[model samples]
Target chain A: ELKVEQNPLFLSMQEGKNYTIYCNYSTTSDRLYWYRQDPGKSLESLFVLLSNGAVKQEGRLMASLDTKARLSTLHITAAVHDLSATYFCAVAYTGTASKLTFGTGTRLQVTL
Target chain B: DTAVSQTPKYLVTQMGNDKSIKCEQNLGHDTMYWYKQDSKKFLKIMFSYNNKELIINETVPNRFSPKSPDKAHLNLHINSLELGDSAVYFCASSPNQGTEAFFGQGTRLTVV
Candidate 1:
């Protein structure tokens, strides 16, 4: 079974600070994804890291993948109140179908 | 227009009752998935269907069944709902295996 673990399950950071949420998986997988979910809302895709060393950044969030280590990371640069949400990292395994195993989410609360 | 959508954004039912959650994707994707997010915010994949074919079924109980009537629709039916089943259910789709997935607004099911 593929297991994904994330660190700092709940984070409370002040605005303008920087933090990183780590996602580590148990098995080998090349595709990794980062998603953000606001309170009472659906998840929104943040990044799709398809290869080792692949990194994607949008707005104030950046995500990177390291397939060999079975790890992925979502880094928040200069956090803002709007960035407060629960972030999840998912690992994909391709067999007869593509299955995504999501990590324990990191709930971030950015305050002034 | 919403790329992926799920009906009944919130459902409240008594234990042992049966309920169904419907999902549809207009992105012309070939793969659809059902995921459950527990109150603790852990997300796990429950089922995966590719081109209307069942591909991935996790260790979910037999009481839960997924039906894919077509390539664009995948619905989940849960029989004898229990309190443990109370959580947010999300539907998602991807163009194909190992690709970026788009998620729908989750259906929050509360088994009272």
Candidate 2:
């Protein structure tokens, strides 16, 4: 069984600050995904890192995967107040069905 | 048009009631999944179906049943719902077994 853990479960930063949330998995999987969820809303897919060095960015959010290290990072660049939400990283294990194991979410609160 | 839609965005019922949530995806994906998000916001996979066949059931209680009439539709039915069953249920579909998934808006179930 693969377990996923994330650090800084709760984050509070200024509107202009930058931060990165780290996700560490127990297995050696190359497929990782980032998702965002707001209050009372379903998850929104942020990035999918398929390969070892895959890095994707959208707006102020960037995600990267390092299969060798069993780590994935979600970096928030110049965060804004609207970006306050919970972020989750899920690792996909390929089998008959790709089982996604989600990590402990990081709740971000961007303030002035 | 909504890529994925779930009916009854908000569901509030007393404990020991029975309810069902319907989900439909227009993306023509082959694999669909049911995920439960608790109040603490821990999202866990409950069941998965591929082409109207069951794929995964993560040790969930037997009271929760998933029916997939077709490839594009997956519905969740819960019998004898309990207080602990109060959570948000989301339906998601992917193009393939282990690929990018698009999620529905989610159905919030509240058991009082």
| Among all candidates shown, the one with the greatest DockQ | 1
Tens-digit lDDT track of model 1 for B5-43: 999899999999999999999999999999998888888
Candidate DockQ values, in order, are 0.77, 0.75
Query: What is the per-residue lDDT of model 2 for residues A1-112, given as tens digits with 9 covering 90 to 100?
Result: 8899998999999998999999999977889999898987878889989999899999999999999999999999999999999999999986666778899999999998
Which parts of model 2 are misplaced by more than 4 Å? Answer: none
lDDT of 1 at A92: 82
Identify the leading candidate in terms of TM-score.
2
Grade the docking of candidate 2. medium
lDDT (Cα, tens digit) per residue for candidate 2, span B6-103: 99899999989999999999998999999999888998999988889898999999999999999999999999999999999999999887677789
Docking quality tier of model 1: medium
lDDT of 2 at A82: 94
